[model samples]
Target: MNAARTQTDRTTARSPRPRAVLAALAAAQFTVMLATSIVNVALPQIRDGVGLSDGATTWVVNAYGLAFGALLLAGGRVGDLLGRRRVLVAGLALFALASLAAGAATSPAALIAARALQGLGAAAIAPAALALVMESFPAGPARGRALGVWGAVSGAGGAGGVLLGGALTEAWGWPWIFHSVALATAGVLVAVVVCVPRPPGGRDEGPAGRFDLLGTTTVTLALTGLVWGLTTARGAGWTDPRVLGALGASVLLLLAFVVIERRRPDALIPPRLFRTGRVAAGNVLMALLGSVWIALFFFLPLYQQQVLGSGPLATGAGQLPFAAANMLGSSLAPLVARRIGARATVTGALLTEAAGLLWLSRMSADGSYLVDVLGPSVLVGLGLSVAFVQLTAFAVDGVPGKDTGLAGGLVNTTRQVGGAIGLAALTTLAGSVTAASAHEPLREALTAGYRSAFSASAAVLAAAALLALFLTRAGAPPAVPPAAPAPRPLTPEPSRAP
Candidate 1:
């Protein structure tokens, strides 16, 4: 009896603290997301430093996203098989080395190669880190709080990238931007190793599933082609031969991938995942949210620079309001969800986002940033942050620990793919509008194009709102410690009040 009591007490004492683990995981997430946008502001300096041709300059940015999006599923499967912590640490090491290489690159090709490597490392880090969060926090308020921090970091990371990159490039140099990332990554790695605990099972122990080579190759290549084609189409026309060819290849390859996965005993991403209504719906909503978020960032900058005549510094500063609001929303998401339920929260958020986009669509060439842009920016920021927090939590809820990494990968892939495709479509539409209005003054023409794009984005958000009403209704009973009640079903019966 004494020995049993002592053992129980020791086990209780050894239980991990949630705060340290959440901080480390949030930091890891922030580091990888920061990589995505940090290069944008430094592109000109990078081009000049490396003597990159006009066309080659784009590759420096595109290479990372291509590799990240293509290999995310495979990375997640590796984590599920090998171990999440092991994969995360390995990814951080690889990311650090790649960042160092990128910082030291003397040529465009070298920089692009390093960036791609960084993407591959990020693919590993992102899913594993998310899985760690899922495993560490139980399915209740603790988990909700952790996810809110993660979502806040994700939103702020993107916004901060522009600010950090510009400051680094202007003050120190272009290479320092990468070097700074390398140092931050190194610090996060140390923190993760020290602070984040192993999953409920011991570290480095997971089902040693057989690797699926054919499935991996087909899906990775298919996604690569899709993202590349969409990204290129934004610059080159959709009718461009390369764009059309890549899209064609993506479709055929995706079909082949589906066939391979159906037959394979160990698929990279099991088709069964999509069969779950909650998982499927969460992914769909995330994709829509991602599309609108990316489009907002892409076009708002153009509006600031072209229509408002803001300098780069001022334009970057103009984004601060959105970032601040997003962080506030992330913090508030869990509290609001607990009060109202996830279904209502998501529906309300989508509607709010649609309203914001509609307001933004009313911008004119003569509009002032403070007077016209601030309100909509804050609304959209809050909406995006709240939606991200709820969707991310819901997507992985009730997923077995073994497949947590896979769930993470699927949500991320959907977001990336959706953003790429939606941005391409919206950009094309905006370009056409601009060309048609060429007879108008330049500022007016540009404003006209931006307005049309924002209007389309609003429609997309509204459509997503309708889908959310149906799809996000499923709810798991909250695990202990007194959090929210079971979320209302997305498609509740008429008798049950949503």
Candidate 2:
């Protein structure tokens, strides 16, 4: 009782500024998200240092991705179970330590392991931080402003990572990429500890129940198999024994996961949420949009580096337009969403994205960045910015406040998992396209591959827009917009009494 009361005191005290917690949360989000791009600029050096083949080195990036994306949902649930602040701090600390391990690693295996650890930490931190923001701010203009700042920083983090990675790689070698993450994230972690308040209802981590351990196991194995199948489809035919067996195993495991969720007292993926159109639609779109995004980052760099003969740093720089546009669009999204309604905003955004993707597909041996890149960027930027901001609001509409964190998790998980699948498929398709152009010079072939991939990506984004249209309920009066997301999970919230 005493402990519970003390926690209650912390929630009600009002001593620390709420905006301070918001500030801390935003910075933490930016720092951790930088992990998404910090490795891109160092791909060459790390490839050389670790003696990794092209396919294998992809894992150095995907290891963190696989871990972070797979575990995001479970991480969100964990935050709801433990105190959010405690989890955030611990995640930051673990992330920093993992960075240190990655930086000093001497072997390929060590580096891969460290990267996985970093993902694990990120899984914990990302959701917890979002939950913190949701809890810290009320759901209105204040939350909107906070989310806008969060979104801009989120976009900027990618640009920052690219620039920083290039600088570090040039000045201090590949290990410096890892070292920079460690040093920067640690500082943010300290600030978070000092500022963010504990949950209001005390250690509000509800009673510990038996987690869906079986469901978790099956899902993990299933995704691992799927990724494996996708990864080696180039070397090993899709019909090859290894590939077929893994994919077949994945289906079986996923089926088992569904059965497990149905029987468990506490399910891993609660089916009840899917009954709501907003939750279900948001999740599906998140997955598909993620695919669009991963495809762009994967191919855009190749376009600049392999085709244009730009170096790694220059390749990173080429992405600046998208990043900057994403920032501008995100910053302005709430206003747009408020005016048009979240659903309409999402639709418009999707159309914009489709237009951009179609234009982007025209890349050639000598493509026009000014014509091809700039115009498409406007569409991509406006579409993504609008869609992301609005889809987030759509995710929580009519959801009971208590389910906010889970709601957040569902959407975020779709994005992470979809990205994994998208990357695998797009890379495979690009390889086939490039191989078919064997008569062309190596650079020419590579450019052909990027063009094909970019076109396909645009189609997917168009599909996502169409998907968003049917997923949301039509004709409902627009409610006030909710705060958006950058990281993978939900924020805490006050109850929504009718």
RMSD of each: 5.6, 4.2
Off by over 4 Å in 1: 1-16, 199-203, 271-277, 474-498
In the predicted model 1, the residue pairs found to clash are: 473-489, 473-490
What does candidate 2's lDDT look like per residue over 441-487, in tens digits? 98778877877787888888877777777777554434235443432
TM-score of 2: 0.89
lDDT of 1 by residue, 262-376 (tens): 8998888776665543777888899988887777777887798789987556766777888898899999888888888788888888888899999999998998898768899
Output candidate 1 Cα RMSD.
5.6
Candidate 2 segments whose C-alpha is farther than 4 A from its true place: 1-14, 200-210, 234-237, 275-277, 368-375, 474-498
Clashes per model (N, Cα, C within 3 A): 2, 1
Model 1: lowest-lDDT 10 consecutive positions: 489-498
